[model samples]
Target: MRLIDADKALEKISKMIDYCEKDTSVNGLTALFQVGDAIMDCKTVDAGLVKRGKWKFTGTDKNGDVYQCSNCELKIGLDYETNYCPNCGAKMDLEEPE
Candidate 1:
C-alpha cells in the first residue's frame, strides 16, 4: 500500500529495463531492476479487485490501536446483512494515502 501513481511506477520500471539493457558495468543492477519491477507487480495485484468495488479494510490505527472488523470480508466474511463498514472503515480497499 505505498500509494504511488501506477502509471508513473510503470514508466519508471520501463526506463529501468532500458537502462539495465544499456549498462554493463553494474552487476547489482539486476537485483535493483527486479525490485523495481516487483513494486509495479504489487501495485497491480489488488487493483482489479479495487476496480470491481470490493474494499479491504485495515483493523488498526497509527497509534497502534487494534480492532476486529466483525463485518469485514477480512473478518466475518462477506454478508449483505451488515450495516457497518468492515475493518473499522479505515479504507483498506482505498489507495494508500499520498
Candidate 2:
C-alpha cells in the first residue's frame, strides 16, 4: 500500500481530463477513463507526524511492570511487545540487556 497526496493527484488528473476534452479522439476517451480508474484506486496520504521511538520502561501497574510507547505514552504489556505501537503507529525498539 502506497500513500500519496490526493489533491496533487487530482490536479494532475484534472489537467489530463482537460487535454482529453480538447482532443475528442478515441485515444483521448481511453485516457479519460484510465484517469477515472486511477482516481478510484487512489488513497490519500495520512496527515500527521510520522512517529518513531523506543519503548520506555516507566512504572509498575496491576498487570505488572509495563513499557510505555515514547511517542504516544501508551502502556503495553511485556507479553505484547512488538516492533510498532498499536495505538499511534510509532516504530518501537528496545535496548539490548547485558
Candidate 3:
C-alpha cells in the first residue's frame, strides 16, 4: 500500500465540490463531500516503524569484512547486509558514505 497527504487530497475534493455547486449541470457530488469528511476523520500514519539507517564499513578481519549499523551500531561481517538491521530493525536504506 501507499500513503498520501490527506489534507491535500481533501482540499482538492473541496474544490471539486465547490465547482460542482457552481455548475448546475454537474451532478452526483455528494460522494465527493463525503470523501472530504472521511479524510478529516481518518487517522494519521507516521514513519515511526520505518527507522532509517545505513551500514558503514568498519574493517576486514580474518573471518571477513565488517560493517556497522548506523542506527544501533550493531556490527556484522560481509555478505550479511540485509535490508533491515537485525538488532534494532532499522531499514538500511540511507544514502550516505559507506
Candidate 4:
C-alpha cells in the first residue's frame, strides 16, 4: 500500500477548475461545473484521508474506480482511505484495476 499526497490531489483539482474556466460552451461548462463542484466538495470533505491508511486493491469496478480496502477503523465509502474491519486486521477484498 502506498500513500497519496494531498498537495498533488489538490493540484489536480485546481487544474480541473482551470479547464472549466476556459470552457466556452454552456453545455460543456455546465457539465464541467457540475463535476467540478462535486469534486471540490468531496475534496473538502475528504481532505483528511491522506492521514489514514490505504490499501490498493487489485481490481476495478465498471466505473474504472481503483478498488481499495481501507483500514482506517471506520466505515468504507467513496473517497475513503480508511476502512477497518473490527473482526480482525483482515479487510474487505479489492479487485485490481485492469
Candidate 4 error regions (>4 Å)? 1-3, 26-98
Candidate 2 local Cα displacement, residue 15, angstroms: 28
Error of 4 at 82 (Å): 30
- Estimate the TM-score of every prediction: 0.31, 0.40, 0.57, 0.25
What are the per-model C-alpha RMSD values against the true structure? 13.4, 8.0, 6.7, 15.7
lDDT of 4 by residue, 1-76 (tens): 3345557566766776676678755466576666556455543333332333336544556555443445543333
Q: What is the lDDT of residue 5 in candidate 3?
A: 72
Error of 3 at 8 (Å): 18
**Model 2 collision count:** 0
Candidate 3 residue 57 Cα shift, in angstroms, is: 1.2
- Give the number of the best model, judged by TM-score: 3
Which ranking of candidates, highest TM-score first? 3, 2, 1, 4
When summed lDDT is taken over every stretch of 10 residues in candidate 2, the lowest stretch is 89-98
RMSD in Å for candidate 2, one decimal? 8.0
Clashing pairs in 4: 58-95, 58-96, 59-95, 59-96, 59-97, 70-83, 71-83, 72-83
Instruction: Give the least accurate 10-residue stretch of model 1, judged by summed lDDT.
Output: 45-54
lDDT of each: 0.50, 0.77, 0.79, 0.51
RMSD of 3: 6.7
Error at 24, model 3, angstroms: 15
Better of 2 and 4 by TM-score: 2
How does model 4 fare in lDDT? 0.51
What C-alpha root-mean-square deviation, in Å, does candidate 1 show against the real structure? 13.4
